[model samples]
Target: MQYLVLASRCLIGVVFLASVSTKVAGPAAFAAFVRSVRRMLLVPSGLVKPVAGVVVAAEAAIVVLLAVPTRATAVAGFAVATGLLLAFAGAITVTVRRGTRTTCRCFGASTVPLGPAHVLRNLLLVAVAVAGGVAAPTGGSLRLGESLVAAVAGLVLGGLVTVMDDIRALFHPTPASRRH
Candidate 1:
């Protein structure tokens, strides 16, 4: 049980780290990400740069917050993760419901548009965050077998979350649009 919670924490941490790494790859790439967010969010054109910076920084912070093995930090990470996922889902929902399709620069530049899969993915992440927050373990100790299981679980879950957009793109034909 403790190992399960730990694995969840690691899975979410990996997701955040991946997001930050992709967004922070280079200045032009980050600027493109900013533009995508502005388009998808329907925000004022002037706010794109700041919004992009905040999103990237928040993802980086989530990675650091969840990396700390302390109980308090774990709780904070989970809380922040929940909020981020909720915001993501809300944003995607807005685009989908309003009949606007926009590319998601989530985890770097992507041609895939927002769809139900994105919302589902966000909700799934929200569930993981909630679970981790409710059952976060304070100790770093784990038995050999438990450690192995936790490592495998975290890797598999992280991998799945990382490619969610790809999976959605393959199946969702009517996603907002691959281009602006």
Candidate 2:
């Protein structure tokens, strides 16, 4: 149980860290993310920057909350993470349904348009949040060996999740005929 909770916490924290890093990497990155959000949500231009700011702040909060080694804080972090993931999934669903080809500025300068794959990825993250929340312990400490193992597992899983788009592209490269 401790392993599960720790792994979950690390995984969620790493994923959010990656996300927040990309969006705030520079002024241009953030502006691109805001544009993508506006197109994805069909929000008024005026609200786009504020909405993007809130999203980035929320992601940062999750990372901070999960970093705390307390049960309550960790659970709160998981809840926040779940809420954000669900919101993202819902927005992505709407965008895909509307056939909007908005570029996904998620995790840096992704040129890939909004699609079902994005929705699926968000849903998967939500599952991780729920599992972490459910298994979270009130108070516990992992041994050195256990800590190292759990941390490594979580980091690897988080890294893989963050780069899933790239992984998919590798498997489904554009056909040679289309390159002409």
Candidate 3:
């Protein structure tokens, strides 16, 4: 159980880090993607850039906050994950309503379309965060090796998933064909 909790924390931390890094690495592209999604929902165009900045900052903060050795880490992770899930859900709804099948852009330049799979991924992360919050662990002792290993594994997992999106896009091409 303790191992599971630790693994969950690592996974959540890695996921947040990867997600934020992608956005930070390509602010213009992320902003453009945000604008595309916003336009689909008929949101005021003026708010797009600001909203994109806020989202990127929030995600980065969540990753940093979760890495801290404090009780607040779990809470912050939970809040971040919940907020992310809600945001993605809203985006999915808007995209579906507008009938605009654009790439999700969740992982930088990935061609994975915004769909139920994306929503489910966010929801699963939310669940992991919530579980971590409920089982918040003390960070008194320094298990540097173990912790480092977990963090690295988490990051690798995130990278693999992001790459998988690209691989699927390459082989499958269109979103509709990939879906079936």
Best-matching candidate per lDDT: 2
Q: Which should have the higher lDDT, number 1 or number 2?
A: 2
lDDT of 1 by residue, 51-91 (tens): 77887878888888888878888888989999998998998
lDDT (0-100) at residue 99 of candidate 3?
Answer: 74
The candidate scoring highest on TM-score is 2
Each prediction's TM-score versus the true structure? 0.88, 0.92, 0.76
lDDT of 2 by residue, 63-126 (tens): 9999998898889999999999999999889889988878777777666676888898899889
Residue 173 in candidate 1 has what lDDT? Answer: 52
Give the residue spans of candidate 2 off by over 4 A. 175-180
The Cα local distance difference test for each model comes to: 0.80, 0.86, 0.67
Which has the better TM-score: candidate 1, or candidate 2? 2
Each prediction's RMSD to truth: 2.8, 2.9, 3.8
Full candidate order by lDDT, most accurate first: 2, 1, 3
lDDT of 2 at 86: 98
For model 1, the superposed segments whose C-alpha errors exceed 4 Å read: 137-141, 168-180
Off by over 4 Å in 3: 137-153, 170-180
By TM-score, the candidates rank as 2, 1, 3
Question: What is the per-residue lDDT of model 3 for residues 1-180, given as tens digits with 9 covering 90 to 100?
Answer: 344446666777777677777776665767656755575554577877777777778878777777775667766766776787677667776676677777666666665566766666677767777777666654444477876776677666656655656666677677543421
